[model samples]
Target: MIEDPQGTVLALFAAFCRVGGCFMLLPGFSSARLPMQIRLFLAVAISMAILPLLWDTIYPRAADPVASYVRLIVFETLTGAVIGLIARYFVLGLQFAGTVLTMMIGFNAPPSPDVIEDTAENQLTNLISFAALMVLFLLDFHHVILRALVESYTTMPLGAGFNPQGALITLADTLKQTFDIMLRLASPFIVYGLLFNIAVGLVNKLAPQIPIYFISLPFLICGGLFLVYFGISSMLEIFAAAFIPVFEGR
Candidate 1:
């Protein structure tokens, strides 16, 4: 049976739109403020390029006029958005860790522009978030992303349909894990602050004239800076260690 070129072209364009919309919001992919038209065309070009490559794999059989085509577009778009959101959430988790860490350490420099959300994140949050995001691409973490995207095709094929129940559960799990990981990454500062504050409070009570407030604030701030400096490397390492399993199902 000969394949319909018109159907193939329509499907491919639809796929491009779906994928491009996701990339528009995805971290690192569409980092700049490119207009939607340009972004869409870029996505379509890439999709066209890949469509030829995945012709046998992705090409759908033609059915009755109009119904399946609309379904294809909607389903593909939703799935694409879901995939992009999942990947972006992990990056947000990393950003969350940085924000919490900075807040704890008194290092936040807020109101700086953010490439991810295209507004402004706290400067410290922006730094760490950008660095972590770069690391993901540097390490070719997209390999994992692409693997998931491919697996999605097999696990939830083109016409397999959406499952609200499964999506909700997975989204909840991702958010929960994201929060847990952020806390774990920044827990050191929280612990240090807690203990240090307790000691400072006690010292103040015991020696009321010791100039504790001014004296201790500098000491506390310096101590926090030093701890963060020492812990930064380990922080990234810890994130990397825990991050793999979350997406990899390891």
Candidate 2:
């Protein structure tokens, strides 16, 4: 019943290159704890599922004898990697913001294993990043990334070479947008730390004998924790809302 089995197989592998490339760097899927076998199969399965929808586009490019199949494979992989990196960069930006927030608020607890990755991170940073990531999962943010992957065929069709300059521009834009949002989220804590430190410095200046540093640290931690408790909901809301636009390159 099937015609051109060779071409079909070639097309499927081409699809896999792209899908697998995306999953290679995708946030949750790319975590160290996720087995490579599971990642491979999921990429293959998605490639198979999407191949039919993109059959016309991928098959022609893949089946052509002169089309440099190896080149096509490389291009497809890079294209998908670029898309995945955009999302990854945004999440990394949030994690960076969490680190800044912790430093600003004086939450210098011992570093522990990250909830999502293998790296050691401040506990508060771990909490904020993990909560944000979990919220994104709950909101099904991966669905948006999938939609983008599906739509990418039209923009960067099979056999079309990867555009490094364009990809760089897109990633640069994502960083800019991500930095803006993350900075806004952490601004309150930054201001709080600045004001608190200034006051403590003045009090120390007035009372040169007292251990002002030790006295102020507890208050700093307590106030920072209180602010986090009250503001966390809004911070997560803002983070989730900004994700789609940033990922979509809007």
Q: Model 1 over residues 1-250: C-alpha lDDT tens digits? A: 6468677777576657456656765667766755667766767776776666555557653232644776777777777777777667778888877777676665645578776667878776777777777677777776676566556666766666777677667767877887888788789988887788789899999998898867877777788889877887777776666666776651
Candidate 1 clashes: the total is: 0
Q: Judged by TM-score, which candidate is best?
A: 2
Please report the TM-score between candidate 2 and the true structure: 0.98
lDDT of each: 0.71, 0.91
Candidate 2, residues 179-201, lDDT tens digits: the string is 99999999999999999999999
Q: Which stretches of candidate 1 lie over 4 Å from their true place?
A: 1-3, 32-38, 61-66, 108-110, 209-213
Q: Where does candidate 1 have its weakest 10-residue lDDT segment? A: 58-67
Model 2 clash tally, residue pairs: 0
The best candidate by lDDT is 2
